[model samples]
Target: MRFSVPLAALLGAGLSEAQYLISEMSFGYAGRISSADNPGVIPNFVVSGQPTKPEILSSKVILTPVAPGNARGAIWSEQPLKHPNFIVDVDFRASGPDRAGGNFNIWLANHGKDIGAKSVYSAGRFEGLVLVVDSHGGQGGMLRGFLNDGSVDYSQHHSVDQLAFGHCQYSYRNLGRPSQIKMRQTSTSFRVQIDGKTCFETDRVSLPTGYDVGVTASTPDNPDSFEIFKLVVMSDTSSHDASSNSGDNNNNNNNNNNNNNNNNGNSNNGNSNGGSNMLYKKQSSSGDESFVDLADEEADVFQTSKSQFQDLHNRLQGTNHQLSSVYRSVSRHHQMDEQRHNEIKDLLAALQSKVELLDEISSFRQRIVALENEVRNMNNELHKKLQDNERSVQGALRVHHNSLTQRVAESVPGHGKLIAVIIGTQVILVVGYVLYKRRRANSPKKYL
Candidate 1:
């Protein structure tokens, strides 16, 4: 038991915190054995039987061997299971050539109870629940569930058939591979899955805490190999003890004290109205076949309200599940949004670099425009200075000509003819200078 607690502690320490469960169950185990002859010790487990002890092999536990009649054996947890949310995965095999009479069972009953080949391969009457895989009818195996509160013995009355809550047909015999049975229970529901498919589920059933989990097999006549390959238990919580175990302890002690309580007691007439709780599925014969909810109570006024309450509770649980899914989706979207934002930041950095390059080009074009304006201003100033120089030279030549004419008139008699020749030469020079200026102005000006 201490070893089992540490295994749960190890699981909790290595994993992140669970949302629903804070404390883990203390009754988890993995099956193991060292050899065929030697019955190896598995932690948190005990083996008990009526005939010889069951053989514990390295890979499987043989509850019943071939050709064994009136043989019975059971392997069960050593401690009470206190955790409410748990999963049990059982890998088992039934190898019988034909209809060899035998049955296998798993139980959650009072602590320290010795379970043997009894009712449905378990005790015919128990204080808790029994799940059965019956192969004794010579047909495909039938998986059934039952409940009792320490009363009504099906073994004595042979009334297990009438008392069954629900069952489904499963051909588990002669399968080459191990058939897997997964029982998953949460706070609001209990579901059974066989061979990776859901077999049955109930949201109204509530199993009390502090009960032991067990596996047993029986052979009334004929031979069969009912072997358990593995038993695995898991929970979604940290390892912690149940706080209200005192109440469970009292109940377990009472059941132990009354060990001789005849499972055949006829006080409730094959049913318990007070302490024993049995589940019944709605049948087509009953108009209220829709009423598949189970309690110890028979169809009466008290059961109606209880069933209604359970239905409301189931609805609330559904709403909670939907909310959890939405939350997970939102978290994923948030992560994606952050990734996209980072990508956009990088893209913006690249665009910013290109904008800076374009700004540099614009600056270069502005400088070229300023240089062109300066060249145009220089060409205009040069043209104005050339015009002024030409005007001054013309004025000096005219003044010189007038002075020469006056001297010639005073010194010689032919002044009139000399003046006329000089006037004609001046007119020809002015005409040639004006034509050259017009030609230069008409040509295109080359900027420096």
Candidate 2:
């Protein structure tokens, strides 16, 4: 029996290859996932409560307590999952100074947009799955899974019986080494592995659509710390076994043609109906048959070559896209650096102007000091001149008083009563003679 397979079917089979990368986040880059704005890039995480905002430190996302009290925080991805069958791989390190005891949760929840303070603790009713690595309250290194059906509300306390669907224990904390956690989920099964060891698996799994992934951490009294080195999400494509089946069928058809040719009698027909037609010919008595099936082989080779080329093209395109994203990020950083440099230049210019003003102020102060000293010297000289003038006037007054006293003493020096009377008579006679001479002089002047 001969079989015919459609070329469209073969091509369709080749097109349905499996395994696609969705998103990858390596905190080593300068742009933070929590602050990314590009749609292709991871968006900034929204943090609630007093937990420290996720920070990129030492090329890792460091999640620590913002304060020393009962500090708890949650950070959720802003983007929703694109596929139902997906895998999440994370590289992380957990450590503390004292005994390692804290709770770390990884949530794939439908309420990503509504994630708030209670999301981490399973406080309110939530719909999705939670994978917990708990090392608190003597339950050290406990790994567990919880599924919320959205029918029942979560209690105030997350009891194991109330919250957990399945659980296992592993020594994850204080290992002094980094650990990798991987989770794969499909329509029928969900599995979790820690450091390449299977921690939990369940066949009865159901996750809702439009789920978002997140991480939350809390510590009571210990100084617990969590650092995420890398995080990636990948999507699984539909099965690609159709291409293999088609190839096998083609091989079987070729084998059948060979067998039929061996059984036939000798043939010699030179008629050609293009390369796609199979030709069979028989001779009279040679008992030999000839067959040509070139088109089938050529078609298989061409299909394979086309598929390879398509795959290579896809990989190159992905690589180019990644390179372009990196280039944009680097360019943005460069522009920011240039802006900072300009601002620093302006600041330096401002400081220089202030220094010049200070210098001018200092010169003015020196001149003022010189003027004050000159005024002080003038005041001292004026005071000294006033003192000298007062002394000269006092000396002149004393000399005048001394001269008058000497004259009075000399005039009264020789006689007592007799000298006084003789002086009086001489004075009286001189007065009379002076009066008579004045009277005669007056009378002669009148006659004249």
Candidate 3:
């Protein structure tokens, strides 16, 4: 009896069919990479612009530092992706001032001419796809896709926004966490996802083999930081292999014709099912030959499991590194919060001291008011006593004057003159005493 095991069953048995990983096919795009993490090995992407490449720790790479001025941030894959149908997962973060015009780009295209005249990220005559996540002044992330076939100069192109085929806006900046950008390319269509949710897809988009990957960032005068924690590219090559084998010559002709197409002509007008998240159509199996190909590729289940375990280990290690980073971030934020709390505490203490000083000032004012009231009472009493004394003296003088007048009438006129002199002297003494009391009451007094 002939052994008839279905390829689907083999896949179910953990034997991945024609799908290749990145590391497994690095040379000439044949790497069947199972994972992106290599404990000590640097990643396969070369950083652009910077002559000195940074070490890839835990698959994280820094494209540019957050600084003012329109600094270019870019990174390119070392190998050109040969698989036509592939999936790319990009985890990144962009942060800066609220008004920072921060943005980063994901590009897929053939090798471009190396020159500063062209964005250090792309070539002067480049052909491929670009997905731009722009932070519209920190309002949110504007996801826009562009298809270019290198005829026009992108450097001087003013109205690139008009060339966008599909776009969606979402808040993906300053999230305190990373946002994922997922892109899938198939023979018939291309698709993009943000945070596992499909944003847009286009059937009109077609990418040939031998396309490389790249990322770039840009910021305004108020610089924004764009960081990439991970970039994982994987592929489902069964359909691509089938199509490539069907007609080698036809594909070459198509590639040439498509390459010559204008970049602006790529419009997803009705080609994309916006917000639908529908998957692309897969190529149907051509018959018994598919089984034969799958049969020839059969391998030991034990080795497959062993390879999977290693990939799992690598993934765990990478996860540990990411966790460590998150821990550090959390710790830093905690420190900042503690510092802010202490500052607030100090401010409160100062405010309390100020309140106490104001209370003392208010008490002092009340005491001064009380003293002024007491002095006014004393002056009033003194004035009353002086009034009483003046009344008694006036009575006595009146009585004495009457007596003198009577005596003068009864005795002599000379006695009358003497009584008048005595009355004048008493009036002068009373006037002097009243003036002295008024001067003492009006003068300033120091109680303390």
Give per-residue CA lDDT, model 2, range 1-448, as digits (tens). Answer: 1112543344344344234445431222333444444432234455454544555544456555423635565667676775668877777777776554566777788876565544346546778887777663365577778887666666565464556777777767667877888889887898999888888888888575578877776666655777666666666531122233344355446655763563242123222112212333222131122233222333343345444454344345335544653464465556545654664565556555666777788899999999999999999999999999999999999999999999899888565778889999999999999999988888844353
In order of lDDT, best first, we have 1, 3, 2
Q: Which consecutive 10 residues in model 3 have the weakest lDDT in total?
A: 287-296
lDDT of 1 by residue, 1-448 (tens): 1224544464444334232222122122323444335446445678776677787776677888885677887887777776678777788888875757677888877853655445452365568777788763556778887777778765675556677665778888888889888787888898888998888889977788778878888876776778888776666532322332333345335543442242223234332222212222222321111222333334443354544454345445335544643464465446545644554555446555656766777788899889889999999999989999999999999999999999888887677889999999999999999999999999999999
TM-score of candidate 3 relative to the true fold: 0.45
- TM-score (C-alpha, index-matched) for candidate 1: 0.47
Best by TM-score: 1
Of the pair 1 and 3, which is ahead by lDDT?
A: 1
Reference-based lDDT, each prediction: 0.64, 0.60, 0.61
lDDT of 2: 0.60
lDDT by residue for model 3 over 1-448, one digit each (tens)?
A: 1222542354344332234346522311223222344442434655554332323344355554566456666677767776768887788887777777656888787773242213423344567878888854344668988778778666567766677788888798688988989888777788999998889999998888777777777666786777777676777643333344455335334533552341123233222211111111122343111101111112343254444453344345335544654564465556545654664565556555666777788899999999999999999999999999999999999999999999888885577788989999999999999999999999999898
For every model shown, the clashing-pair count is: 2, 8, 9
> For model 3, what is the alpha-carbon lDDT of residue 264?
23
Spell out the clash pairs found in candidate 1.
24-238, 149-276
Name the top lDDT candidate: 1
lDDT of 2 at 274: 23
Task: Give lDDT for model 3.
Answer: 0.61
TM-score of each: 0.47, 0.44, 0.45
